[model samples]
Target: MKPNKHSIDFGKEEQYLNSDKFVDQIICGDCYQVLKEMPDNFIDLVITSPPYFQQREYGGGGLGNEDNIDDYINNLATIFQQCVRVIKKTGTIVFNLGDKYLDGNLLLVPYRFAVEVQKRNPVKLINELTWIKINPTPKQNPKKLIPSTEPFFIFSKTDNYYFNKDAFLEYHDKCLNNGRKKVGNEIGKKYFELIDRSILSDEEKALARKELNETIVDVHQGKIESFRMKIRGLHALPYGGQAGGRLSQIKNKGFTIIKIYGNSMRKDIIESNVETIKGNIHPAVYPEFIVQELLKLLTKEDDIVLDPFLGSGTTAAVAQRLRRKYLGIEIHPEFVEHAKNRIRQNINNHTLDIFI
Candidate 1:
């Protein structure tokens, strides 16, 4: 069937989304039909987990349950082509795709989709994240490794995308001294041994010992704080002091630990327990933590977020809770009602104070 197109009235794509009709609304229609009507460069971020191949039959005659792998990839390419047009130049698209099996043979669906989508669209795959579900369903056969990880492929419309690196900060209480003896024990012994071995005057030896003691005290009491590791010419340890010299540099040389405010450096692996929401009949619902993490990285306040396969309304509810505008499209009427009810309960019970 040919997609029914609707007229877009606003002069520019940016102005088109300013109208109230599209924001914070869920449209019950086919994803292709709804996506074709949207103006170009209108959506700020796109986050969705499209149905896997031969996974589910959602009462909509579409690509998820296609037996042929080539047909499945082709159908997904068409949907993402529309997504590339709708997303802004500085926007990002995060797709969480899972693996499937055909006749007991494992099909690498996520990697194939990533490669095929890039061929059809101008988007580039920037980051590949692994969602390690702690409580995934156990397979009856114990021959293979337990299925615990899923892939999240992050794509950007342009070379420079809008990413908020500081939004997802993880606070950890790290000890000041690690993998070393306490102050005045191991360091003091090493300093005295150095002073005795060196061919220097007594005064010089005393001065060196005093400086080393002061440095150790300063570091042990948390007087200094280390940030990120600077990629220097040599393999140096992380040091928090403001001192500079050949000795100081040599002292801070082997594997050092640094403290960065944000956890962007370690975001490639996500560890979360699988979520089980009461009354949610959708078998493949994403946890709220996953959506929240993606939103923090990709969107800002009032930015428009779109979910083409709005299963159980996890994305919309999380987007609303984060103060961003959202638009959801679900093809099945039963899922449309399911998503609406879930969004309503989320707004009423969780985000009521924020909206008011």
Candidate 2:
């Protein structure tokens, strides 16, 4: 499967999808009906941002057109229950749902959906990712500030879900991490002085000096990028945020060390603006880079990625670019056509060697 574009005449297909032909094809069909037809343990990674409840006119009046919030939740949750059945034991689902504001108050649509799906299925909530929109839609209500965040809930049916933490770390490193830090000429000299001047027994000073010297050797030998030592009496106590391991180590051992590997920043929040592709007719589309990051974190080459609510084929495009198999189910024929054209253009824009 060396970067070939799949073509499916969705209108001519009078029968349900054959599971073997799901790879690299974007089909026009209702999600629940289509998913029910597929067998169990099919997809490797499931990712989609379904139509928001009453956010806009999707023209396909199934999931988003429910009268009340409960109806909407039930519809979405039932579909998710089907999704859970289709994914493998090690598969993961990443669902991004937007919040709706009505009658001067907010409806916790995403959170409520999270609760509903977990209650109905044999799934575990792995993580809640908060996507911060750099440019959000403006609100004319003078009484309230603008809403700029949405949630992407990640779920897994079992504990064997595939998570490439090194790839996840590399994703953040590309965005927020710099290369190895350069040390000054007097790297550990100040720590030696602080250790000697501290109110500690001679034994404590000797141990501190030994550890500091070893750390300096590690830095120079390129084992680590950089480090900072906090003396018990001189420097403020180190805070390891909520984990508090660093602070406990300082209290017990009379010193603490901060090590920077320059690999990752521990963060659940990501910043991406809403995207609108040129040929895309869908009202809402998530950013491509966000999908790429998640794909890198959760999948390997040739793994199947499914997006049930394929608006503009963002998932398909990113999957193809990354050399992964993708199957998208779009209900609207017009949106399906748009997704096809957009994905074709996306394929032509770059070769397999480089992804912009």
Candidate 3:
């Protein structure tokens, strides 16, 4: 469909709107107006953190001018209506949002937006993950309590949407092993018992148990004849931590023990750290980790990804890095320049692997 020319004013900003320098370029214009021009089912994934209603100044305008909560929901739904039309049937939309506080009442903007998106679009509510900010700024409310964290709503257009369970699993693994330590005497007793209870002949048992006994001896051989060293080494080796050092001292030793008696487990998602363009063009710039994770999960190398509210071009940058095609729309000129510079820099730095 042709774009609604009435809503867009691509006068002097047309220079940055289209570019051949970056394989995935940034467009400078209103997102609602620009999205209408894109072809249908052209994008693979849509991940963005839209401006919160009436929260902060994004230079384009203020987000908190919705008049009321209902108006905010309606406006968000209108944007998603267009987003749903352009997104592929198998595409996934992950929206990072937070609640808004007004008149001392905390409005659940995240939940409200999720409900509105599901109501207006064909997306399915998949997960409501909490992004617990480790070092969140304390809320400055004298009368009430402090709020610290936010929510990320993960939605999909179909049941067969892309999800990298392995990446999430790796995150879970790190969290699980944060304060893990082995139970020294208890573990030793269990290990010895298992060795003694073997039904094999003496020679067979000796050979089979030799490896286990050697492993235990190696732990206590050079170190102080304590179980701490053994347990520390075991934990470190599995977690890819430092192998041998005085830093391996088991202070306040904790153990993340995993008992595996049945079948082997496999994770579905894979995760990696991705770098971002150096500049604060958008306030709520999503981490490249998120974009890379989404790309790995949702689409193939050649698939297309779309971001209607392409703040600082994180989605496009990640798409380029992962060798995927991307289309981004931004409503602000400053952000458009920021995104364009970011894309160009990534291309020059060999961060983006453009396919065509």
Using lDDT, give the best candidate's number: 2
Q: Highest TM-score among the candidates is held by which one?
A: 2
What's model 3's TM-score?
0.65
Q: Model 1, 286: alpha-carbon shift in Å? A: 0.8
In the range 134-252, model 1's lDDT, one tens digit per residue, is 89889886667778999989999999899886454222213223433454446446445756665556665566566656656655664443232222233343445653443353454
- Give TM-scores for every candidate, taking all chains together and pairing residue i with residue i: 0.73, 0.86, 0.65
Return the TM-score for candidate 2, rounded to 2 decimals: 0.86
**CA displacement after TM-score superposition, residue 265 of candidate 2 (Å):** 2.1
Consecutive 10-residue window with the lowest summed lDDT within model 3: 255-264
Lowest summed lDDT across 10 adjacent residues in model 1 is found at: 1-10
Give the count of colliding residue pairs in each prediction: 0, 0, 17
**Model 2, range 45-80, lDDT digits (tens) per residue?**
999999888787677644675667777787788789
* Candidate achieving higher lDDT, 1 or 3: 1
Candidates, ranked, lDDT: 2, 1, 3
Which scores higher on lDDT, 1 or 2? Answer: 2
Global CA lDDT computed for model 2: 0.80
Error of 2 at 210 (Å): 3.3
lDDT score, residue 176, model 3? Answer: 44
Show model 3 residue runs off by greater than 4 Å. Answer: 1-23, 62-64, 168-278, 352-356
Per-residue lDDT for 129 in model 2? 81
